[model samples]
Target chain A: EADIYQTPRYLVIGTGKKITLECSQTMGHDKMYWYQQDPGMELHLIHYSYGVNSTEKGDLSSESTVSRIRTEHFPLTLESARPSHTSQYLCASSEGQGRNTEAFFGQGTRLTVV
Target chain B: QQPVQSPQAVILREGEDAVINCSSSKALYSVHWYRQKHGEAPVFLMILLKGGEQKGHEKISASFNEKKQQSSLYLTASQLSYSGTYFCGTEMRGGGSQGNLIFGKGTKLSVKP
Candidate 1:
């Protein structure tokens, strides 16, 4: 199994609450990503980091932000959560070097904003 | 770029064969295939690196056409375990792009025994 892990496998928070979803990988992967997926829907890339101090917005415009302070950890935070943010958040990591390596995904965090 | 998947869903009987197709407008450097069951994170099935590359995992295999910017996943002798949503993630280019992968909407497959 992949060493990646997402904390709060499930979260339910009220609107306006600040929340952070934790993602960590022991694989020492340089590339990390956050994807939002609705049930039975496509996985939308929201944020990604090539390495420490490097973060980029994904194809989807999301209200959440992420930081890559350590190679093993990338966390997504929302200043003020909303009901619209209720969905599954998946974290993935892959080896870098422009190798196009396969991504390893965590179990994912199911967030429900009430 | 986000890839497009055809036949939003498909139904198959045990032992039947099925194919799911994915296409992208942007040039593809690599194609990644994944399968996800209900309320679960997607599992990496396979990846095709080179153009016109074909790889197999058990009864499941995939083919990539670089010039056409398309990839197709084939499932032979499907089993109940094959029931899930299949997604195709496309990497930016052959040279790679920060190792980011854009995915297709996904194709839901149901195998009935």
Candidate 2:
């Protein structure tokens, strides 16, 4: 199994509540990413970080934000959750520049907002 | 942009063979293949860089045609363990330094006994 890990494998929160999905990797990878996936749909990149203090938005516009203060930790936060935010959140990390590197994914966190 | 995957889904029996194709409009730096089981994280199978390279993993193999900007995954003698949703992720050349991949909608594969 990959060393990457996502906290709160499953989360249930009321709408308007704040939540943070945690992702950490022990491999010390320089690239970290957060993706949102729905049933029978493609995984959409929401946020990613190349390294500490370097973050970028993905192709898909998202309401959530991410911070990479540490190489091993990249966390996604939503100030206020909504029904539309309910989805499976996956975290991944890749070594080196990412061009030829294969990404290792975490187990993912399934969030439900009501 | 996301690549286009053909045959949104496929079903095959053990010992059968199948092919999944992914096409992109942009120039690709590399193409990665992954498989995800129901309610599980995707597992990387292989990566094919430019120059129309081909790589194999066990009974699975993949070929990238840089000229056509397309890649194909081949599964020979499919086994029940190969049953899962197959995804093709493309890394466009100009995407940026981060090199994040843009994934296709996915192709569901079912291998029965």
For candidate 1, the chain B TM-score comes to 0.90
RMSD of 2: 1.5
Per-residue accuracy of model 1 over A1-114 as CA lDDT, tens digit each: 899999989999999999999999999999999999998888999999999999999999999999999999999999999999999999999998656677899999999999
Residue pairs with backbone overlap in model 1: B29-B93
In order, candidate lDDTs are: 0.90, 0.89
Chain A TM-score for each candidate, in the given order? Answer: 0.98, 0.97
Q: Clashing residue pairs, candidate 2?
A: none
For residues B1-113, could you state the per-residue lDDT of candidate 1 as single tens digits? 78999879999999999999999888777899999999888888989986455443666788888888888898999999999999999887644353678899999999999
- lDDT tens digits, residue span A1-114, model 2: 789999999999999999999999999899889999997689998888888998999989999999999999999999999999999999999875734678899999999999
* Candidate 2 local lDDT, B48-78, one digit each (tens): 9887554547667888999999999999989
